[model samples]
Target: MQATNQSASAKPLSIRINRVLYGAFVLLSLYFFLNGSYQDAASNLGLALIFDPFNQMVRWENRPRWQRAWLLVHLLVMAGIGLVYWKTFSA
Candidate 1:
């Protein structure tokens, strides 16, 4: 009985987290795809290099779960910075 209630409560939380993760993935993918063609646009090389140490810290199955949280924060911060860069230069 208690187990059943716990499972029911967890389901909604999991679903909400999953939806946010999917949304972030789609947004990041779109940002990369649309901006990838330009040489002047920010390159993935820098990101890969910067985050390499964190990447190496995780085991395979658990990596995605951890990276998703890391990336969601990263995207929010970087997107804000990127927007500022764009606004500063493109003017």
Candidate 2:
């Protein structure tokens, strides 16, 4: 019984940690986006989506059809930006 209680308590703590990390990733993504670092922003956003803090942000089931499709759109846009940058700047 004591072990069960400890396990239950630990679950919420882990969830809270995940939420904090997800929030940090989301903020980092926004910062990168504002600075025109599309690749980094997309990477961080993808991480946040994968971590899925609280299941409240970036969840496919919680979103409308268009919003769910936006994930792929976002990735494609970022890839295009990266390709442009590489072609323009790479040796």
As a whole number from 0 to 100, the lDDT of residue 41 in candidate 2 is: 83
In model 1, the Cα lDDT at residue 8 comes to 82
lDDT of candidate 1 over 6-26, digit per residue (tens): 988886676666556555544
| lDDT tens readout by residue for model 2, 16-38 | 88889878988999999999997
**Residue 77 Cα positional deviation in candidate 1, in Å, after optimal superposition:** 28
- What is the TM-score of each predicted model, taking all chains together? 0.40, 0.60
CA error at residue 44 for candidate 1, angstroms = 12
Cα-based lDDT at residue 23, candidate 1? 57
Where is model 1 more than 4 Å wrong at Cα? 37-91
Window of ten residues with lowest summed lDDT in model 1: 39-48
For model 2, the stretches where C-alpha displacement exceeds 4 angstroms are: 55-91
